[model samples]
Target: MLPADGSGPTLAIRAVAAADLAALLDSLPPAAATFARASGFEAAAGSHLVVPEASGGIGSVLFGLGKGSDAASPFLIGKLSTLLPAGDYRFESGVADETLAALAWALGAYRFRRYKRGGEGGDGPVARLKLGPTVDRARLESQIAAITGVRDLVNTPANDLGPAELAAAAAEMAGSAGASFRVLAGDDLAAGFPLIQAVGQGSDRAPRLIDLVWGDPDHPKVTLVGKGVCFDTGGLDIKPDTNMLLMKKDMGGAANVLGLARMIVDARLPVRLRVLIPAVENAISGRAFRPSDVFPSRKGLTVEIGNTDAEGRLVLADALALADEEAPDLIVDMATLTGAARVALGPDVPPFYTDDDGFAAELAAASAAVHDPLWRLPLWMPYAPMLESKIADTNNIGSGGFAGSIIAALFLKKFVERARTWVHLDIYAWNPSPKPGRPDGGEAQGIRALFAAIEKRYAGA
Candidate 1:
């Protein structure tokens, strides 16, 4: 949505609050001000008033900031990108966060039209934002591309984006960035990633461990692990039809890490980057591993399958174990692992857990700075007992339903021992409803904040 050339005649978008409406009206042309007043525009949040030019064509637009805290949101301006007609536009006033406002504009302009028939998906020209020189054009563009890629990947259906396709996507990205790409599947997967293999064996589609490595080997190591469950039919346990509807986004964790990896590689961040994704489909068949089955993880921990539906953490356990082997400076794993996380923090804000307070603080600041909502949840070692299994070292799920998100994080923590710092992001990855910059579909949640934190820690190293 960012246009490189700002030479054309562009409409100015002025921000106005309820208290500032009178001042804005006084500044506008007489006819435009009269029309605005006649329209009864109160400058409410997400509300907009278009002013007409002397020639009756569109002139400047006044966007509502509402009152109080809503006025400070950086993404509030994102609404204009979709609301306005096709043309170039620029902000006439300052926003809370100019960089994020620009980012939001581009994000808001995104439309997933892959499966839409001609003329059905709003294929018309889109409104473009003329970014100011103060913004980092390259960084903003890279973030947009990366986040858009996440949305696209998560939006794809299971049949089209199975483990094989997911691995191919990672390989393509790695090749483009000059990173080393490897896949462990078939016999190799069974031999190495037992947990990843156990979870995907139910589906006809094979399971794979996708590995991508880049940057200087001597630099500080940062490992990212994402759960790539292409589809979760809940295995033999099965899910209700309503629950199964959005299974296509089960791989959202993988999509996010790939997005974050793209930003890091594109920016040429000075750290050794390793991305490990366990791509699988938790389908049902005779080959599916049943409940109470025990699987040896890559980390050598025996995990009892308490429920087949809790498959995300199983695959992630193997990948996280592999990631921890090198004892990277930081190990961050993102997964749509539990409904408890959604219940606790909702879909917009994901909950993250980390034992390292310094890293947590940095992440918290980054989250606030970028407007990527992330709430830090305690690891809660006292709840670790809930994962105790009679037959195995641990159970895939907690003993009861209490603190499910924390329990899942604790289970993952069992696999990660050597990392200097480890963070787990329990993300929903889907927007149930449209808001400002975020649309009603797959979303890139914690990566923006994670990228900011990682860049701050290792940019010059």
Candidate 2:
């Protein structure tokens, strides 16, 4: 959190690395050094020590930066937003990336209080950061708002955030950005997006194809498709209680894309942006599409339902097909589609698939620069046979469990033929535990890295 104006008496926060702690203490005033020495302050990452003034009031805070080869990330400073007392504070030194540190401070201050009575949560007033002139205040605020929007949407219970509600949220965002928004539901949705309809037919709420277009038509076209499985019960193949606990975050992909779209629109990137979300709920009922049932997709490809739990890709397939029809300069789709990705890279790093090496390089560079972890996974053609179907053109899931993430990527690749470049992101949109700048609930995984790459590619075009 940041203050509107730096007019208050702010406490100075000095970041000291573990190896530099003794030197820093020696340089400090005698009383302060003695206090720190007595306190046994070792400068471990995320650890802090508070010093008192001679008048018995607050003086300055000593924050840790860890040691070499284990130095804390710039985001580690985020911990200070909640750790420090409710007062204005300013970083005195030791932050390498000021902008990112400021952004982290804002992100760390977020709390999901929608369900809390009277919106009462947290222990006390949040610590406010006095951002320096080097930090881009507007940009940092926009990033915070966008990311928190994703967390809010994903944290919402499925009972309150069905396909219809998700569409409404997208419509609201579009209206605010002066973009054209439309939702195809009922007969229109069934006719246009058969895969989307099939996935949602079991739910009473019905499905929707949410479309939003913004920016100048003459600009290079960039389309984003997100899997909006509002709630995934794994259909007839019901998931066990343990796996079902976090199903509310099934639409995290949709939430993330909307967040990324907000960033692009706010920054006014020079590109025609189109967002497609096939909002659905994969529930179990007599009408649920059965395993082994064959269905025709929007792209004219027939798919066999190999497994009901693989419904995220079913909805995304239709949306990606629709996005590819225009043969946009680029097509990027994000989905919380597979656990295999998490098994491979864990929750902190999501795997992305793209054929364009140049664009992949740019994404990798941007990812490292922004600290948004993304790893490139091959769309291995060798795994194509695993998705073979006996009756349909292909199966919704692979014949074997190996390379599941890659198989999912290959499956979506089939629907995108016209786009000059296409990228698929398999994201675990929920953080399992609280960390610096990232809380335990829903997260916007790859949007920042994707935005950086997009901005670089199209900002000057």
Tens-place lDDT per residue, model 1, 1-461, is 78886578889988888888899899888999999999999899979987889998889888999987878888888888988888888887746567888998988878787788873356678888888778889999999999999999998888899999999999999999999999998999999999999999989999999999999999999999998999999999899999999999999999999999999999999999999999999989999999999999888889999999999999998898889889899999999899999999888899999999999999999999888999999999999999999999999999878999999999999999999999999999898998889888999999999999999999832
Candidate lDDT (C-alpha), each: 0.91, 0.91
- List, residue by residue over 1-461, the lDDT tens digit for candidate 2: 68887577888888889988988989888999999989998998888999998888778999888888556477898888888878888888878888898888878877788888767365657788898888878888889989999999999999999999999999999999999999999999888889999999999989999999999999999999998999999999999989999999989999999999999999999999999999999999889999999999999999999999999999999999999999999999999989999999999999999999999999999999999999999999989999999899999999768999999999999999999999999999998999988878989999999999999999842
Instruction: Enumerate residue pairs that collide in model 1.
Output: none
TM-score of each: 0.97, 0.98
* Clashes (N, CA, C under 3 Å) per candidate: 0, 0
